[model samples]
Target: MDHSYLSSKESLDIPYITFPDLLRKWAEKNPNKTAFIFVDEEVDRYELSFGELYDKATKFAKALIGHGVRKGDVIALNGRNLPEWLIACFGIQLAGGSPLCLPYLQKKNDFVKVCSKLGRVKMLIIDPGSDGQNCQFLKEMICTDFGTNNVELPEIPDLRQVFLFNHHASLPSVNTVAELCSREWDVDLPRLDPEDLGLILLTSGTTNTPKAVPYSHHALVITAYNSIHLMKTSGKYDSLYNNRPFYWIGGFVMWEVNSGGSRVTLINAMKSSSMATAAAAVKTCEIIAREKVTVALLVPSMLDLVMKKNISLRLKTIVTGGMIVHSSLLKNIHKLCDEFICMYASTELALIACNTFTEKDITNTTKGLLSCRPLPGIEIKVTEDDGFLLPAGQRGSIQVRSTRRFNGYLNQNLPPESKETLERTGWFCPDDGGYVTEDGELVVEGRLQEIIQVFGWKKMFPFEIENVIKTKSNVSSAIVMSLKDKETGDLPPFAAIVYHPNDEESCESMQDYIRKEFNITTENRMLEYLCVPRGIVSFKQFPVLANGKPNRRAIRQIILETVDSEKYE
Candidate 1:
């Protein structure tokens, strides 16, 4: 593969701009152009224009300023991908304030915790009754309609004002969207610089409390622009999928699509009332086929569900990550799209490496792991535990320095993940462990901190085995963890699984299948022998942590008890 094309920023046809400034430019260039196609749960569709979106955003900015919002103040947007929610986000940013988006469906305690971390951060823009019911710290509540019939203000201290959008629920001093839009509260906003904090994305926080990652106006725009070039989309009318909610890092793809000045097609799955049920995925498929969507993104798990329905997606590029993609998924998903792209990323540093897989790249050797080509302006290094750089193909902790690095973590109290992992000179080593290919592609082996420690044995990532087990049609979820060997004090990994209730693949049959798949082979003995799973255990379902990752500790305990009570072959 040629390395020359990867070094040039000149290949990026789109010009980067501050996110707020881009809105202005788009409005001027294509006033009537459809910026968003919003579909409600009821199947109603709305086509908003660049001019209309900017007008509304400007109105909201004025309203925020009128209500005493200043530059650098925090404005939290909580909702599914609604037009008004994004308008408010742009409005806050245009008002010289920063915007932080929390998933609209978050529980009360989670919302409170995020607020607490920000140290009395007060403003919250929410969907009518989403997670705003119990955020006691919000001094002002901006509520938008998201299929809710009526809005109610729950008992919350410091939550003094209620601002409504597209509704007429009147209460004492409750402001209407109409009033805000037609108001004369105008102020001159300053021009934005690259260093201005534009967006704050919350991590999954699978291990601990969710941390806030702040990206500067420059970082967000540049990263988004880079995504377009990396994906290699044609110029105009190229439509990108907008099914994922904006709260996750996956949502950054939506911003990337917009930065390219292309179309972002939103299906019904992103509505506030949507649960992304099987029906919703089907609906999304229908839209993808109907619209001839050029690009679509999905997590590896979602690919399984989508493929089960046997939907043919008219997509040119399919972007997938979030979990190790099974071979079956890789092969089958390729049948629906032209190319399969796998990206390695984190919340703080967005896109690291991108690999576009063809039929040749779908072999068994690439099943559990695919080496992704490092993107332009991104530096990746495999370093030893003591910070020494390792040679190619030698496994070590993954560290990166890239344009996508966030401005900083929000909580000044808690030391940033960058404090230890990120050096003063600007390198960030995530907990992940992986090696690089001489070709400059990175092979990600799960997180080093999350790796199941097996004493004196080859280092193995649970994702490697878990992803393999997930390839089974009957397996709904799989978790592999190291259990304490009571006799020797050494740990060996065991597989815990949740099989489909209707499917009947027994534990014995599963064990036989695993033993056969990983049995002694004729060639590459090291490769064959290293693929060992010590034991198998069954679970009804995997316990999930607060941030939606598998509760590994709980799964290990369950597996440990199974190992203790009975001896296995």
Candidate 2:
């Protein structure tokens, strides 16, 4: 599985220096500076100096190499946000292998699926509590036992060896990755090229099969640049707290790894009460206020909860992504924080566009507008249906090409159509329909896949409908989709909204409000009658992913199933 043809120098403008190199440089530049801070076993906050982190990572790297792990092999690290997890990541990179970061809280099935997807994984590095028996790929499980006595070790049938970090056992040869870092070896460590795959992230898919996207070291470096320069991120504050899980692209690459020098605070507990939606929001707000957090990234849903709780934080910039940020939400956020930046990015591309709201830009029509341009080395083009480039102020599909783009899917087994689509150009058509304004600003309309066609007339985008509905008072979230019409034998647009749980407004009142606000009757007569949703169900809460994006697919399924069963009854 090793491909030595991919030279480390070929991967980036700066060859020989990889992500671990950056850490080493930082350590040299600021040895005593705090590299990381975490609440230790005694519930007391502990700090790791840059020099200490470098030492630990170097040893871990040597340990990995000592264990016969070679360049280009995949190493999977499964753990919550901890010092060991961070060390393992850099250590793996330093060892000349890619680190496959898995979600700490993943179920057994998902863990197995991810392991199966990563066919070339050489080893599994896990935290103390991980039940290796449930994991299918652990031929050699190395546990960095962080501080637990009652470690009910599971019998892994395929496991050939188990190495405990803090404990000594008559197991296979164990070298604390942190220990080998200082020893000098005659063998030259494999250099990191710009194009060398550095990490593998599993993206959620429509089907049960999860697709893994491998990112190069250059891709990560570009991600850091984009986060700092394009997003205008400032880490001058005391600490950085990211709520997103470490597994996802947004969490690991963009937020955690990119902000390398900052103190990354993570919430590891997962009980319903421990990580309650409201409590998470409040804790984040509190951290921002207490720690003087300069930059924070959260999903719109989490922002909504923070706003609802009236939790105030002294944040310089709060970047919200995962879903579109509503104008109303932005307006409310402005009252709490100084800047609210709306970012549009995906796992494939680090960051595409962003909109920042200063106190001045918060006024009048510029509220929910996306204000930034494409990142450096990125080219964006809007093309019409005929494959011709569209002029300014024209609506079309957004095609983007970037050096930071992912190499390809992990398996390299893209479907014929997908491969053809990608091969047409380096530009990725994420299926997002949008238009470039006269000022060259990209205005996202909606997903082409989610677009609705009713009879002969085309329907407005779901985002457009959702945006309008979201502006309504007490409406927390909304989704618009096309449902099959019994009479016309065609699909008609339908709206499903979730309002503030305690709101006492009647369905008729809400309907009237939507009808009046959207001018439902006058503009489009068909929509006024046909698009008016047949059913509007109210839930106390909205289903959301760990990263804060709405679980629309799950919600839609539940809605359909409930409605169908009701009809049958």
Candidate 3:
């Protein structure tokens, strides 16, 4: 591959530092400091120091080499957050290979799609107990706990070894692979370039097909820089705890590896309302209060639940993203936490823009509309429909250009020349309808694609309805969509609401309020007797991704599957 396209802004050329180099620097500085702390069911507490992590990673690298794992080999870590997950990631980098972090919730189709995209993965290091026995490519299985029952392993022609951390003394071992770790290796591992691929992340394809986004070592460094400088996180002052999965970019870049040498506390459990309840019940709140966790990243709904429940967690800074944060919810969050930072970002551009709330900024109705200046190494621009760059304060498609931007999607066709022109300009037309305020803040409207035409008049943005619904006391979260009307040949918008289980009356009141607020008079409306929601179906709770973002696509699918279309107007 030609490397001449890369350039450096400072002495620290991003493309020059690999993951191993970064880890080595941190280890040298904080040799005895704890790098990761995880709590497992069997092993109550698991911790690893910088020196210990480095040593283990070095041994794992040698183990891979001994098993014929060569440079550019694709390795997969397919399980929940654990010490071995980080170890496997570092080991792959040290052994000059790319590690693909797989989501624990992936089913048959998702798994098949990922495997196909990651063609011919050389090795797979999975948690045998957590991952179950359905993996298609199980070259090596490692159980972090010793007492886990040894189930029948999957049939893989390339499988070579199984290393159990706690049960290595009694498990049925095999040849061609060693149960030994870094404690047994005295040899040094190979190095990597900054441009070398570090991890392969699959983009969240809510509106379209999923694409594999490959991040280089330089890109990872840029993520760390953004976290430290742009987000203003300090190791000396800030303690971080992240429950997000290690697979997604938001989790991996923002939570797991962003702080460099700072300690990261991981919650190794499936994410759900029950899990949240269990965590709160276990006095995790007390632990957080004791540790004085200054910075945190939580999903909006989860934050709402935590705040509503009055969990006494002392947090100085709380940043919410990965989904839209309602104005009402934003204000409530501000009252709960010392400092609240609301951000809008995607995998393509790690942390595009964030709103750091001042006391005055918090009370503004435009609180959710504040525009953020591009980070040090990034550039942003807005453009019109004709592809002309728009000046400040003008509403147009927003585009971004950053040194941290991903190279391209794997196994996916590149956008056309016309589309490429839009992308190269760094003016991402997020297709979100919103204008930059006079104060240079970006106000995100609803998605341009989601706008509906009702009776030839453009109806309100879905976000508008969602925001309004969220203001209703009992409504937890809401999604509004335009449903087609068969009789009138018009698209009328309807809302699917998720309310507190006991708030049936509140839901009915909201329906009445919306009908009057939107002025949906029975005489003028196409469906005279039927208000908007031809059918109202309630869900126990909305599906949420590991990163705390609502699984809108999944929820939409569930709604479509459960409700009868013919019943509605």
Candidate 4:
């Protein structure tokens, strides 16, 4: 049941081409075919034809050259899921420059400090605000619906110029997107090298600071192509619904359109104001039912909200991940959607594995991590600390190797240990602990580097123990960590939880349950020791970190000072 593949599954082969070449190919054939349908906040959907998409990108590329944007320059793009974002990105690559695709930020941080990591940014094209409550307020004050206004940038030391996308707003120094589309120029596009840097994607800093991962033109093209092939989605789907601005699947669909390979309809759920909301469950229902979206990918954070919604869905597949999904949440997703898949990936290693679930999988009693087969061209292996491969079902370090990996980090001095770790060919050890099933499926336990070495007979992973506690009554969120027992110098694990309204569960009750059911009878020595929490604490809500994961390290620091909560006895 781990890695199921029918003998009839066809061998996948993805065609690769550079951005300019792909655009030209699509524009040449079926010029009138719709390339993308962008749904705006006002519920109006605008269709951009293949010819129009290519022509606009070409004009923008020419305008970039006219404005001193040269080959090998670095330009940053900040916007929502709009045609303009794609236009600028393809234009940057067509002009032989690298486009740094930044996520839409609500609040402006220290610009000088943030921009320093980008090296020298030749120009910045940004949507002053996108579509949502946070963006609505900003858009009302700063930008037109088209996202442009003549406001001073936050003084980025390396920023040369800024461009906004509103049709009405104009500035002497700043350029409007309307001008970009029709910036009169007649110059032949520069010859692009496939190996030239095309895009820089920042890592989602779930555990640490984000790093810039550079991807070459051919690498990105092949990566996107391979992704679609792995999804096993043939022909055109009804509409590809996506919650986020940029997901790997959506990128694959875009590349499919650009490469003239497929013409599946794309539904950016975030574009329609009614679909994207500060709340999760209702928005999920609205986007799917309203758009009749056939396929989509959401994150595990949406589970709490998704469980509250009851609706009939036209969805073919619902892919979710980026955190461990509880079986309870999976039940809600399973009943609402046809197919459920868990996508396991990192910014460093894109799309490592995607495991589809079955009816039996829903009720399976195994508390271990879910299983997924590695992508066709990618290799996954389990290894011990001694640099040797481990047998199946034995937890060890996880390693992945593929040709579609990033070129390297933008800032070479990042992660300091990366040089030593990736010193070998294409193989990347993510430092996650996992075991391969006998069926060749990979199971990720958690980050081995982040595992806690509690003072005991065996060390434990906080994620494994935390997942167990989350199954408790009325628990909203749970975090497990180790605290130093000062009297005996023993480091016993502590469990902290936030409860949902109504069903009252206290620390004393949680500890008593664990001590009886876990500490007394479990024959598995490791499980018996790890599951018994030495202490339990309750918080109304967990403090969130930069990238939205619970800040366990910060919470541990606070608990160390207050109350004699570290005692195990």
Which of the numbered candidates is closest to the native, going by highest TM-score? 1
lDDT of 1 by residue, 484-531 (tens): 556555445678888777775666677567656666456645543345
Model 2 deviation from native, Cα RMSD in Å = 7.3
Worst lDDT run of 10 residues, candidate 2, spans: 1-10
Q: If scored against the real structure, what TM-score would every candidate get?
A: 0.82, 0.79, 0.80, 0.79
Better of 1 and 3 by lDDT: 1
Give me the overall lDDT of model 2: 0.60
lDDT of 4 at 101: 66
Q: For candidate 3, list the clashing residue pairs, or say none.
A: 146-167, 371-441, 371-442, 398-427, 398-428, 399-426, 399-427, 399-428, 400-426
TM-score of model number 2: 0.79
Q: Residues 111-174, candidate 4, lDDT per residue (tens digit)?
A: 2334566677777777645433323333433333232322333344445566765432333334
Q: Per-residue lDDT for 1-569 in model 3, tens only?
A: 11101112332234357767767776777777766666554435567777777777778888878667777877766666766767777888888888877666455455556656557565656654443332323322323222332223233333333343222223334321224463465455666778888788776665555667788887787776666654567664566655567777666734324354344455454543224443553455554554456676766666766777766555677777766566556556655567777777776667666667645655575444444555556555566666666665555565566756544567575667535764565434445655555555566666655555556654445776666566677776677765555666565556677776687554456677767755777566653223345445566776665334457677666666655566433
Q: Per the 3 Å backbone cut-off, how many clashing residue pairs does candidate 4 have?
A: 0
RMSD of each: 5.6, 7.3, 6.3, 5.7
Please count the clashing residue pairs in each candidate, in the order shown: 0, 9, 9, 0
Cα misplacement distance, residue 455 of candidate 2 (Å): 2.4
10 residues in a row with least lDDT, candidate 1? 1-10
TM-score of 4: 0.79
**Using alpha carbons, what is the TM-score of model 3?**
0.80
lDDT of 1: 0.64
